[model samples]
Target: LAEHVVADSVLVPGVALVGGGPGDPDLITVRGRRLLAAADVVIADRLGPRDLLAELPPHVEVIDAAKIPYGRFMAQEAINQALIDHARAGKAVVRLKGGDPFVFGRGMEEAEALAAAGIPCTVVPGISSSISVPGAAGIPVTHRGVAHEFTVVSGHVAPDDPRSLVDWSALATLRGTLVLLMAVEKIGAIAAALIAHGRPADTPVAIVQEGTTAAQRRVDATLDTVGEVAKAEGVRPPAVIVIGAVVAVGPDQQP
Candidate 1:
């Protein structure tokens, strides 16, 4: 296959954006694992199934391309340049990210950069935490006769931020589920916005931290108190915040 593929010029040096899947190493797709195993170099983010990195062969060069939204990390330009540089050198480069690369993972930006630089790129979709995390906690993002739709948004910035694009008022009017990733830091403000925008103060909320891993823990509260409860419980980043009645439909719910 290797020689036959080379004869047709089908196999070329390029970058693969592989989604590691919500934190669980086993959740990664088969294709993603295969590409990861064959990669010559891997640029990984802080999230995702990081434990899998330890399993890589000694010859596989690993680069820490972690970019924490509000924290110190590598610049996006540098990460793109790294992929271009490595692939141009005839190496199989893998850009491993947590969850689906296009789901707020900045995979598109990297792909565009690679394309502009004349490098080939492939994307491997992974399970996003927006749904998986809630599911891991036994809470379905969408439940029949409960919630028929769900919306996932980034809470990296407060709703009041000038650069923020989310319309908190519209979100408040949504009768479906609202899943907020990276909102631990701004949960207080987000919850306040939702409540102020018309969401009931008593709307059910669930905050799942380090979801899908052994360290997972959940804190339940209402929209009025979720932020304070999350802070008091020491919920940190990398957690998923679920709002709406669907949160009350988890397997552990009481009658």
Candidate 2:
């Protein structure tokens, strides 16, 4: 079930940024899996399909990148340096991330670091949780007549935070699906922002926790009530929060 990703085309002493897809181990792309199998050293993030690590050969070195949500984590610089050090030693290093590496995964930063260190880097795309998670919950991000566009945003920062780049006011005006990742802690503020920005308070919202995994569960609410609903339901991290009419298009209808 494995083969060398580069074979003769790319050389060793390099890094492969492989997206491990959403939490399900089987969701990873073949290319990503192949790369992982070929790696001599794997630096993994906490959010990906970590169970796959057990499949690696005993000789492989596995380093925990420890990107736990708002918790103790290996600093980005440390992770970058670790990749560089291993690759510099002529080892095939794989940086396995959850969802698409470029989707709020901080993959570009790592790639840039490798480039500056004169290390070769290859990217393997993975399924992003933004779409797959919602889909797993029976929610289509876009529907024929319900929605035509969908916006994916990071909710790590609250709408009122000075560091936040999302234009909540603008987002509220768009009549499309809104997908929020890393936003569980701030769902109340997010929902409030949208409502304050003129979005209808009654817009349907769905919070799918642990999406795509066996532990997956969903809670429903209107935009005005999502914050409270999420709290009452104990919605936690690694969850996908979807907002808009598309939430109503799924098999389950709000009561």
Candidate 3:
């Protein structure tokens, strides 16, 4: 299990951006956990596990590099500087992210910055809260009998032009599942677009927040009303929005 990833790439001399996996410390992969234990400096996101941070050696230096969601805050430049400084000290630094580093975790941006600085950084993938959240809430992204295909999209986009990257018309007709991550703010617009594009207004949808963690919460409703219900339920980000017939497979379960 562990050999496949690193064999695909090399662990470099600079910082390693590790995925902490959803919010559960236990969900961290074996190799990832091992790396955590060996890290000399650990920088993590807001959604990463508190318990995972606690697992680190007491002497390990830690930094909080989280950006305030939907708010103006820590610029990527500042984070890059932190990584460079730590690595320059010849310390084994790990930049831990909430979910998979590649999935909107800004891992790419940091990697690019590191590359420009002649630093060699490694990326360690983790379970994305997007897929795991939905599954934990009993909504499989794809079910053989129900859905054969699925799409995952970041819902954090400009409200006016959210469909720039997403083909709303085609997605509505996919008849497959659509898992939207970080879309709590844009859920209404997203669902409305799907409905307008022929996706059933009553399509079953489940909003799972803090997915795969002890704080996980699920809210079930149809596409037409999920946004409203989710709002009333106070669902936040660090969420996964699952939509399709598969959601009906376990209708009795509540989040």
Candidate 4:
């Protein structure tokens, strides 16, 4: 059906890398939802909530490429191959990723692979988890008095240069917040880095999990104890970590 719609356009044999948004089904954009509905094959990650999957037509094929804690199924290469394979078969493929496709979802790598294979590709942007998670938890990444700026860091960087990717010293000097996405596993190391580099040990920290979802949960504490509280509270990965004086103001308190 999608092929028919694009039959005249030389670009029908392509893949759509769609962002499924951050866990919450409602967060999915109308364009993303429409593309998903038209997809012949949908490849999704763990963070792409199952609710979104259920929205697909019974006839559409849904593939799980999710990277979960216990399951390390498909590699980037394998996922790329799968996308190409389906596209070559004249299938309208949708790589349904959690959050924005380009934001740390490795959508760029996949796009490069598809391009190499001469596959047409387009992106459908969705809300990024880093900022949305914090906002949904009643914590603004930036505030008038509390923060004039903010930095977003990823945990998937070179282990030796995580600090280099972000200047802890500058972050310490700025009156702003630090948003760490995918850094749940390195909370201890990150906290230590910021503290050692001059960010106050008592900087407020909050970890929000399953953000914007019905099951959303939050753990709040100072930088000195966020790591401990996160562990003790059984906070899982795929959580958003917020640090700064801004979060100190109660959730109801606005900037």
Candidate 5:
């Protein structure tokens, strides 16, 4: 039955959740590139390698999956429905996302939805921005004898938010590296929380904006000063915040 299903799937339409890597179009895996080139329709998020979309054939259809229409963002249910609808109509659908599809990109949710609807789905992994973004700024997430372990967390919610799963106090005591995503808007509160919990105010921090792209820029500061430094520099979203001794290992670090 399994072999028959696999063989039968070849002739049926399916969904491919392809990770576009960290902003750079060339960084995408060969398999991902081939799949993108063959896709009949693509549903793309704002953060992926958008340049690749322009390279698609004129017959391919593209949809902005993340666009906010009429002051409201497109719901996840709607996105899933669009994918199922397109695939059922015999079109090869590619749901392209930035970075790794599983790393906070909610690719699993879409996969589950497709499964429930009896649609075949495949996942292609991409390099997560959690690691590549820091590397783009010359900051290694883990260095030899410097940082042995690294933790990646989403800073979209304030430390004090009731829905937050992270323990700010516990994170403060950890000696390893901490990489934060979507935290630019709440850096002040997050920085204050770390300091209040016991992380030294002098801990080195690096913020890499638009990492891995030509527009990439790096800003260095201490834990206590990162908030103000980022604000003064006009650092925006789609940036990565790296905090630890590893930040000092970068070539751009100051004495």
Candidate 6:
């Protein structure tokens, strides 16, 4: 594996996994931005700091991981191969992902593939939307004396789905704040499962759409009403759903 180090902000010819932060371009880290600016080939996702793509030099090759010539987005294997191919060609590659690479970003999978291919992979952390999005909506996942702990979970799969690995029963028993990503469509099932277990139906819940972006909107409801509220409001994906008493905690408390 070609081992490359980011020395004095200099990026060598290898693959750098840069976290583009939640949704705001300004939220991207200094290191992430610097790497993007110097990248010879940037493989980007739909969720990252897309605004920065226009700033890249015309000579840089920008590959949309979510879109390909075949009319279907590139799959994970294809993305890994793209990185390897670009880096093998001596081009500095940047795999720009949304939020922290390890936070449900399939970053570890990419890193493993790169390592297997003997490619030097650099991981740059970004602010996860789990916490940042809630905070942006004026809700803290953990508040002093309110929620002592916070758990971040992916709601991409419904509780009734056999593909789901999450222990809804165990999660219902926890007293900490629950931050759900990709759960808007399955909020009803999730709420039912949680309520069926041990979670209180009256627990406060806040759904923040578009998170920290300019289109951010927050909707409030109790666990009993959240499922319907989400549907009634036409909540969409990329929204952060916060469940627990912390939703009602500060000056930004929602109705």
- What candidate 3 gets wrong by more than 4 Å, as runs, is 1-12, 67-74, 162-164, 251-255
Q: Where does candidate 6 have its weakest 10-residue lDDT segment?
A: 1-10
Residues 1-255 of candidate 1: C-alpha lDDT, one tens digit per residue: 011122333553588899999998999998788788788889999996999999999999999885423234358988888888888877888899999999999999999999999887788899999999999999999999999999999999999999999999999999999999999999999999999999999999999999999999999999999878987898887999999999888557978
Task: Give candidate 4's whole-model lDDT.
Answer: 0.81
**Candidate 1 Cα errors over 4 Å, as ranges:** 1-13, 67-74
Per-residue lDDT tens digits for candidate 2, residues 138-201, read 9999999999999999999999999999999999999999999999999999999999999999
**What shift in Å separates residue 149 of candidate 1 from its native position after superposition?**
0.4
| lDDT (Cα atoms) of all candidates against the true structure | 0.88, 0.89, 0.80, 0.81, 0.89, 0.88
TM-score quality measure for candidate 4: 0.88
lDDT of 4 at 226: 81
lDDT of 5 by residue, 74-104 (tens): 5888888888888888888889999999999
lDDT (C-alpha) at residue 151 in model 3: 87
Ten contiguous residues minimizing lDDT sum, candidate 4: 1-10
Ranking by lDDT: 2, 5, 6, 1, 4, 3
Clashing pairs in 2: none
Name the candidate, 5 or 6, with the larger TM-score value. 6
Model 1 residue 170 lDDT score: 97
- Give the alpha carbon lDDT tens digit for every residue of 79-108 in model 6: 888888888888888999999999999999
| TM-score to native of every candidate shown | 0.93, 0.93, 0.88, 0.88, 0.92, 0.93
